[model samples]
Target chain A: DAGITQSPRHKVTETGTPVTLRCHQTENHRYMYWYRQDPGHGLRLIHYSYGVKDTDKGEVSDGYSVSRSKTEDFLLTLESATSSQTSVYFCAISEPGQGPPEQYFGPGTRLTVT
Target chain B: SQKIEQNSEALNIQEGKTATLTCNYTNYSPAYLQWYRQDPGRGPVFLLLIRENEKEKRKERLKVTFDTTLKQSLFHITASQPADSATYLCALDLSRDDKIIFGKGTRLHILP
Candidate 1:
């Protein structure tokens, strides 16, 4: 219930195609992150943004890229999708100085690359 | 590299019994640890957070214990019910770097 939403809740695409997922937030949090969840590998961070135009790679950023042009929107793009990239993607927002830095997550987008 | 390990095996407990899950980490010092609950097809929801300096924290029937020296955290759900069955994840914050790491999560099944 964190004013966060991910577009295209579910999608199925072929391999080697470009795919992009969008995360929009109304909370105006300073930190936003993209993570992928798979069967054996819990949640692995893909990328994160501290502020508009500021982004950094996470542990599993090999096949993904992210960009943030405004505070409320963060985009995760897979230049050339692969079956290995099929997983549930989640977007989270956090307010650093507000409280415990606890993250609020969006509903999630399920992407399947076949 | 830092690693967090949670029991990959599922835990089954009878309804009304207490259920406890464990999270262990190595090679990193985190400032605080957190627990989250996730149902099938849903995003993780925050449960409890315990700081390194705090030995334990309680909310409702959930209790979380943090042992910085041991690099471990324990989550306990008292008087569990079937509705309590879900996957529980443990996360740690790398305070200095403003990043977090999560464990694979332990699934709990409170059978009635």
Candidate 2:
């Protein structure tokens, strides 16, 4: 288990409501990513932050937004929850300066939209 | 467009038998590929990573073969046990301007 933690391990929300997921890391990795896992679609990256105040959209970035104000924290927000957005979300961290380290994942946050 | 394909069906094998999983891709030249193991209700854990120049990599009872020419990768587990049951995922550095992509995944069940 890495020092990464995702808040609200499980949540049930309604459509058209905004929701936020938080990822906190103690390893202080330089790279952090937010991904969603679905039945037919594998793990799809929604957003990633290379460093504080730097972020980029991933393949499935629509309906999702991210913010990273510090090296140890990254947040993902769903502007308006949709039934299609119901999926297990994972947070990952990687240390590029630490000898090609592999990404470590959190336990995961299961989001269900009604 | 870059796309990754994996077996949507689950693979069932008896204990002491071998299991193989497949991952295929198209329209993308990846620099590196990785395999991961995930259990239900949990996130994935890294298993192995193979480079584009490498053909195969192995660890313990697990073996991975990557064929760039075929644009596919095969993962094998020998003499698998019930504990080896889990979903396997393959990811590539599809990287449009440097990005990564993941395949849906193939579930494995080791029956005792």
Candidate 3:
């Protein structure tokens, strides 16, 4: 749990529709990340927020956007949902300089776009 | 391109036996390596981490060995139980990257 919760545990959306997944953390960790996991391909980072209003792109940051308006919330928005974007999305939180920098992840949100 | 590779096929081990898994990487110098366990439909849980300077790290029945020279890591579970059946992912962090890269994972089945 790690005091982390993601809204819409499961979602089914049509192609070209807008979708937003929310990640809320009570631990107030400075670092939060968004990752998508699919078959064959492992977990791939889509976007990460280092601090309030500070974000960076990861290896696979295309067709996706993120926002961290508050310390407890990180939002992932798909402007136009596509079938290729359907997968399990996980939100992880970690504190910098915390020994090994291990991340605590939320349960995950399973999104399917048809 | 940087890459990390783990056992592509599922590994089956008998109960009470030691199960060893391998992780190999190329084209990258990682500051540390980590192992994570993920059950179906659940997020990954961190198992252990080994630094490049450390040869081996142990926690209870779990042990991780890091060989920088070989650019490999070996994860072992002694006295394995059926409950340990899951996918184990090997991830690495580079000194220059803010995010960790992960291998697809090796699914281990502890047959009872």
Q: Rank by DockQ, highest first.
A: 1, 3, 2
Q: What is the lDDT of residue B64 in candidate 2?
A: 94
lDDT of 3 by residue, A1-114 (tens): 799999989999999999999999999899999999999998998999999999999888999999999999999999999999999999999886866788888999999999
Among all windows of 10 consecutive residues in model 1 chain B, the one with the lowest summed lDDT is: B93-102
Task: In angstroms, give how far residue B21 of model 2 lies from its true place.
Answer: 1.0
What lDDT score is found at residue B6 in candidate 3? 96
lDDT tens string, model 1, A1-114? 589999989999999999999999999999999999999899989999999999998999999999999999999999999999999999999987877878888999999999
Q: Would you list the rank order by TM-score, best first?
A: 3, 1, 2
* Candidate 3 docking classification: high
Task: Give the 10-residue window scoring lowest on summed lDDT in candidate 2 chain A.
Answer: A94-103
- Model 2: residues >4 Å from true position, as ranges? B96-98
Question: Better model by TM-score, 2 or 3?
Answer: 3
TM value for model 1: 0.97
DockQ, each predicted model: 0.82, 0.69, 0.80
DockQ versus reference, model 1: 0.82
